[model samples]
Target: MAIKFLFFPFTHMNKSQLKTVLAFFPACHYLSMNRDFKHDPSLQTLFETGKINPIFPLPEPLEKVEQNFGQYLAWARIHKGNKVNLKSLLKDSPYFTDDSDVTAITSQIKGEKSDKEDANADALTKEQSLLQDLLFLKMAHLCDEQNEGIDLALNDLIIGHDTLIASLRGCQSLVSHVKDKKTIARKDLGEMMPGQRIRAWARSLSAMGALEPQGGTPLFITTSEAVFGYLEASCKDLVNALDIHKIKVHENECENKNEWQHLFCTWLMRAVQGDGIRENDMPVVDDRCSLLGQVKLALFSGNGINKIFNCSDKQIPVCLIKLK
Candidate 1:
């Protein structure tokens, strides 16, 4: 079997790797465009204004490239005025992959603590989870620095929302613990807003392409959960179809029964790493019944969430496909 890619959470990245990761965005604008950015009118103006004659000499060695990009990213904002396009880049390359490396680094973080780690040490698990969330959220905070940052933050959050939607629907397996969640009609989406985060998310959606109120992106995100009562309403048909009876271990009797939070964290971790989760390594509720397996089953079953909201909207088709 080929080796799995190790997703280094932003916390795991040193300053150099973090900035190098951020640099991918500005590099996108230049690299993907046909015109040489060096002689472009807007780029030249930026270089002159920022007093930075940007160079496109990305190093051949990954290590040197990391260092060079880190340096360039430090000034990318001063020159191009775009916020770090981390959300989309992360969606594309969430984890570091080496075909020869067999270790599952994120899995290891939850697998076993160091010999010195105490069970009570700093609530290490929670802290670790928050670090990932904070890193994704930092895009919002960082964008507050400039109007351009605001737009970037919004784009990041919008794209992040789309990415997660793809993952959930693609990997739909409804755990008993995942509450039945639903997204209302797009027109009705406004009634539930006003909470700071949701409002901000809605605003981002509104601002997506053309600035006109009606011309904005049709998607409006209200809550993060996507189950939408699919599990409770259809568990019987689903259990029989997947032949879940064969492997469905009773969670009530399990020692460390998985919760929504655990499954969620595991899912997000996999998404950030940009990896197809090994069927075996998905969040474990018990030896027989995997949290991810159940979710995927629930998603695939008929009369599911994908059928409900996504049938008409269908903005994000799938998120967890490239299973290696």
Candidate 2:
């Protein structure tokens, strides 16, 4: 019988030597010993189950793995003919076999160059076509501008009408609040609102000479001619939309001075209604039969004037009457 002796040696080891020994063992051995189990239990379970496999085989040296990746990148660059130092890359890499392999890579690179040149030529042609289209658009814009001056005038008229309507609405709201039985007079309606801001903007138009001030009144008003001209010039669509027979100017009510004053007040009441001016809390203006005295008064008094009107200047109109 041959005697067999098993030589077991336990020696004091440095950190690196201990690490090498640990690296040689299976991961489970380290977990059992409580030596190197930094990974999560779930991850260890997955590793044990092989659900998530490693990209490469283990025992791979980090440097060699990095070098292998560099070789792959070099090969990719050569295959694509991307600008790179091919000679330096081939210096130490063994994967690139021989001169013939390099020659094949160069041939592929030349073909890619030809393809790129063709693509660039096609791009140039498309760019030139786009440039021509842009030039045509520029010329067309010039022609459109020359032909559309009257359109701008009509737009101005519409804008003026909108401004006047907005101002009238503001006045209506202020007056409505004052008339409300629960509302306090000077306290609530004392200051300006956003509507008043719109009204203030009329002053800018007056400064531009687009509007003028009435002689006795502070409200800068636009003339009927100016309003009509703007409407005819810029807002032909609006004018065309209205029935011509329905159009009426109530200026004839001003007989002398006092009658004219009454007529103006009456016209204002009518204009306010026509302008779609309303306060949310206020009662709607009533319509009476033509034979009724109040109805006749309203008609003759110009209570429902509908034609668009504007101030010539930025002047605030004072409210003299509280219409119920």
Candidate 3:
């Protein structure tokens, strides 16, 4: 079939959600594979330019951490129910603020023709369930140092929750009347950063359509402290410098699924053709194996197919609906 086209009859993610999705993925975290896990050569300049002071431990290579974080997140977002609405999801939370730019993006996720395109609810539910399983595995890995059985325990506690979205707790003041809780655990508190970044990216993506919106435009704003500040600073710097007007959202790659599917196909094809990939081993083209699972998962969600596609499949039928 030479990969004729991929049909994606699904709602597209809005700009804010899409941008958040982008920002959620780690950039270039190339710490050495040795036990020391040294930073990438480029990171020295980035640290100096950004004046970075990181608080997280450097036990594992950053690529591993990023792989763990980004892949699970990408999968969760793909399989999340109700289209991963950062605006409405965080609207009532005191810790987060909704960006105005996400309005258009939200509208897009719902799709222009509701009668023509409604998402696969049952399939989404199934994906969310699987995401919970992945979450359990990740949580176990994170807590492996504390206890060997954490994964099994986490599986039971995670129960039906997809992400740790519900189990998290922060001490909102009953006595102090504080609007946002300050006593949140370091790990739990860190979750707010991604939420803020998601909206910020959406706003920036929205501005991409505008020819000029004035320089020094705020890329992202949040009350998150210095701990989560490291990643956010880089995110803001990148978006702040970007001219989104230059970016194009292709019609076939029009929806998030189709776009992701197209990208995944390109990646998988390269891996299959190149000696860089292996059957049982992780696929690493030019030493970047972490992204393979994410691409595959994206394709699965785009088409609501539960089965993982074989990397060696030469002509996977990825059809496109009539271009918008």
Candidate 4:
């Protein structure tokens, strides 16, 4: 089955209508798979014995850390700054008007002076470690909530909630740690330079009728601000064969998920099978592994499945261009 044919109809669907289509997509696709298996004994045997799985192999079980964000509380403890409190560093206040001032605070938090004076400085003394101790105790309480399984639906919600907050904090710590480090260079997308990426993106967009017909006039394409900036900087002065237009975007108003440029590019790459996309693109569930038990528990508890389909309505942004 060609994915283009399957998903092309979605371009016209509204949100609610689209959900209706998706609700039946899996069951319908599975019926096709079953029909194929029944018609061919070998294929049926492969499916029954799990020699070959359809579309997606079950995803490997979630790692312990992936299963619960509470584990990251321990991670925070392990990577915590050497300074136990920022009160003395900030002169016992929290007001910084400049990057330099903030840098000073972070430097003290990181114990740069202590490291210079003695690399093997002792951990913060208990008396000065009040804030750190309290923070850890709070995290420990969160971990206990998950371990105790207070309520299944509520726990599922907590897992997602904790992951988001913990991830944000973890990212903040990481960025601050490397604030003074040299910037890492962005790698090329496979072998394609920025210009090449733009050209290839144009080709796919045209195939999907995402390109605008300007009749020799320039037509602007829209994309997220990030993608626009990337192309502007990296693809400077690149010539185009198609009737050209500059990329346009509204920084604040643009919804990240609805970025048309990115959404179409993702659909093509995931759904279409050819030299351009995956040759074996199909509707399949990844191996559930140990996480199967967790999902079952959620299901039994009236919590919805957290399974990721091979295809979805809101795809991560791919290309940075869209026809305006």
User: What tens-digit string does per-residue lDDT give for candidate 4 at 33-101?
Assistant: 011346557546545764333331112211221222333444346546846553454456555432224
TM-score of each: 0.17, 0.15, 0.17, 0.19
**Comparison by TM-score, 2 against 4, better one:** 4
Residue 303, candidate 3: Cα error in Å is 11
Error of 1 at 83 (Å): 52
- lDDT of model 1, residue 62: 24
Off by over 4 Å in 2: 1-220, 224-227, 236-256, 275-324
lDDT of each: 0.29, 0.28, 0.28, 0.29
Any idea what lDDT model 1 has?
Answer: 0.29
Clashing pairs in 3: 5-318, 5-319, 6-318, 6-319, 6-320, 7-319, 14-105, 16-202, 20-198
Residue 261's lDDT within candidate 2 is: 34
- Candidate 1 lDDT at 205 equals 20
Better of 2 and 4 by lDDT: 4
lDDT of 2: 0.28
lDDT of 2 by residue, 132-184 (tens): 22222222223333334444455556555655675678775645444332221
Least well predicted 10-residue stretch by lDDT in candidate 3: 4-13
Would you give me the overall lDDT of model 4? Answer: 0.29
Model 2, C-alpha of 313: deviation from truth (Å)? 20
- Cα deviation of 121 in candidate 3 (Å)? 29
Report the Cα lDDT for residue 235, model 1: 28
